[model samples]
Target: MEPAAKLDPITETALRSLHDIVVPAPVSWWPQTWGWAVVAALLVFAALLVTLRRIKRYRANAYRREALTLLEGVADKLRHPATRPDAIRELAEVLKRTALAAWPRDEVASLSGDGWVRFLDAHDEDRTGDTLERLLDDFEYHGAEIVAGLPSNVCSDLVIAARRWIEQHVSA
Candidate 1:
């Protein structure tokens, strides 16, 4: 059997006509929540911190970048077989100038021959500086004498050593 209606048929009909089915209220987008604000702030701060660090590092390593460019020029100079001795001389000068610029001039300027090589080896991580020092000894002293030509392999080795020295040495 059906249960009896709590309201009269007339009252039920009247209420149904007045309103449809109920629903949840719609959400508004006017105001941002605290969590979202904090997240946005943190993201901005992290981005700024990264940018500042990159700038500082770029500034600090400027000398290394310049030295690498000069080393590239030395490679170009070495391309002509006839110019190997002059290129070798130029290579030593570039490395010396780069080191001198990075450190105190007095400490680096007067150093030559094995003394210069030892200084370079002291800064080098690979310990191949003695080989490079030998090249400087051979080429720098005999830059004008083209009769005793330096081997192509030796010149190339000097280039590699100079590149490593410029890249790996810490400014002191």
Candidate 2:
């Protein structure tokens, strides 16, 4: 038993030598983790920008379709004599509203007082510039008095005129 106790010191030295060769682990892994995070964030941002442009295009297309529909409906209604003054005014208002929705409402509405005259005329086939006001006036103030009542043929002509004007006015 005395001989066995004496052997312990050599065994301890061998065990310590084996442990020294192994390297310790790092305390932090943030640098490597953050590199991956940054790349992911950039990809997300790129995707978002593309999505936003597509959404804008889709909205614009929808607005164009809606405006065209409104104009078409108004033209169809105008294809008859005895068209109501109220209906004409309403249709004009719809066109105005649709224009405002597509463009700037305040600016377009203000154009009504002055520049609007030229704006309309610019799109007119004749370039008379006062056609819009003339048409509107006919429906609003003159329809009941001067025109008395819109005849189907007369209304059809007006419908054709309006359709032509709108077709030329709106951009694709």
Can you write out model 1's per-residue Cα lDDT over 1-172, one digit (the tens) per residue?
A: 9998699889999988896679988887644688987888899999999999999988988888888898888887776676766777788888888888788989999998889888888888777776687776766776455513656677677788888888888677
In Å, residue 53's CA in model 1 sits off its true spot by 2.2
Clashes of each: 0, 5
In terms of lDDT, model 1 sits at 0.80
lDDT of 2 by residue, 1-172 (tens): 4655555878889877784466779677554677788988999999999999999877766754676677677766565444456557656676566557656666577766446556566646555434456566555556454443656666555555655565556532
The local lDDT score (0 to 100) that residue 171 gets in candidate 2 is: 38
What's the C-alpha lDDT at position 76 in model 2? 63
Clashing pairs in 1: none
Model 2 gets an lDDT of 0.62
Instruction: Give the residue spans of candidate 1 off by over 4 A.
Output: 1-47, 143-148
Highest lDDT: which candidate? 1
